[model samples]
Target: MQIKDFMIDQSLKELTEHRTVVLPIACYETTINENIHGYIPLHWHDELQFVLVRKGEASFQINEDKITVREGEGLFINSGCLHMAKDKNNNSGCVYICLNVSPSFVLSQELYTTFVNPYIQATNISYLHLVSKEFWANNILDSIMKVNQLIIENQPYFEIDISIHLTLIWKNLIMNGVQLEHEQKEMLKNKRMKQMLNWLHTHYAEKILLDDIARAGGLSRSECCRYFKRILKKTPLNYLTDYRIQKSLLLLQQPESNVTDVAYQVGFNSTSYFIDKFRKSMNMTPLVYKKYKNSHSPFVNNST
Candidate 1:
């Protein structure tokens, strides 16, 4: 089945509105392409996400670190962590199942209170992205596959079973996932920095200054620079540039769009400068990237 493609805002809204009411879930086996070589672009939400790679390999970036997981391996993402997944191998491909669950649905007092509280409390400590080796019995990957099967089959009380298994999975995660005590303290400061990012995302077309972002994050100019570098490994301005590059990619996907139009829409004031940066980050000119995407996609139509 085709998974629904959602914009960032719509995905966030779905996560919030369905927090405790309905379990937000999806499963798909996707064909990977060789030309698409990079992370899926950083994004985040409130729901917990489980990605199980049944076949092939991919690199997953969680927060600041990158982890590689192969077939029979899986990654668990905690709520609100910025992450991206990509297939790095150009010749081979992978198929995976993605599952998203609202934390509140699993943590509610009505069901599995004993197991849920610890998992919820752990979220406050650090984000998790565990890669395990075993794909068979007593392994997180196996459990995730079982849950996916149950979800697809719509078995009786399957949601309950999935929730229960997820609780156990979280328990294992707490045991195995890395402890980030020092990182957690730094992340507290970084959380404020995210406000600047939000503003940039909302107002990319307008001029943004270092002082402006510092004020938004309630930090001194020097402190803001340090904080962003410490967490994201990039300065605020550099992050903004990367964000613009990503936004330009979405615009380029439209067959009618030209490189100049996409550049301006994504906040670049100079078309030549936009082209330069796009080429640097994407390794192709905007038009070239657009043509490559169109040629690779089977669904694209040449005729309007």
Candidate 2:
């Protein structure tokens, strides 16, 4: 299994905005396929997110818990929660509507504090898994889909409609949630993990060692390795290697860039070793992968 944190001595994010601030609510339709990076690597932001899987299936991981969501179902992830996603069925195409909403948007402070903030920050509720069998879950999924439909259609007053739908979802979550007690140490551990991941992701392209990774997490070298093994099922370096390979996959899509160019760009020194590692991870050579993508690209046929 490939595991990754932000970085050995840096953070992992590659976004211009630290938080979702362009709008109170942002909507996206994510179509999953092999060429487009099948996995949504781990990261967290301050906005509350909901995903409605319209087709196929995906497994959403929130910290240690992993839940598989199928068509017509969905999931709600709280703010600042460490999470990632993967295709539950291998090599299958899945379509989902992703919505990121600021917690305080369109709601009064009292309302948000009571119905939203508690749920987002509560230790008991890292996420709300919405399956068809459950009442509120089904309702939430319907509301999420409706919001996506409005966004794609780009109808007038869509923002107002989206916010209304979101309110319904939020109400359901607040009513159904059960708050649990939290341990101080668990909270501390979470903060440390976020910090370490952030550090590693920022500096992965440079030469770094285990000691640096450990210090990022405020743990000794052995403790750092053990922590990663316990949570991600791989050593720190193993995670770093996978992260490098994953980065290389994106760069290889550009036909102008040769294998050696892409390899050194992602911190690998030896072109031959990079090729060996790339093939081992992807089950194909970089050149072949690039050729495959160019031919099978979905955007090539504009007359569709």
Best by lDDT: 2
- List TM-score per model, in order: 0.78, 0.85
lDDT of 2 by residue, 48-76 (tens): 88888877999888877888988888898
For 1-304, candidate 1 gives per-residue lDDT tens digits of: 4332435641212332322224555555554442233445566777777777777887777666678877777777776777766775844576677767667665556754655445544534434444554322236666777877776787778878877877666666656644433345555654675576676678776778888878887889998888778657789889788878877876898878999988888888999999998889888899899998877677966565
Worst 10 residues of 2 by lDDT: 1-10
Model 1 local distance difference test score: 0.67
TM-score of 1: 0.78
Candidate 2's displacement at residue 298, Å, is: 9.1
Question: Candidate 2 — what's its lDDT?
Answer: 0.74
- Model 2 TM-score on a 0 to 1 scale: 0.85
- Which candidate leads the pack in TM-score? 2
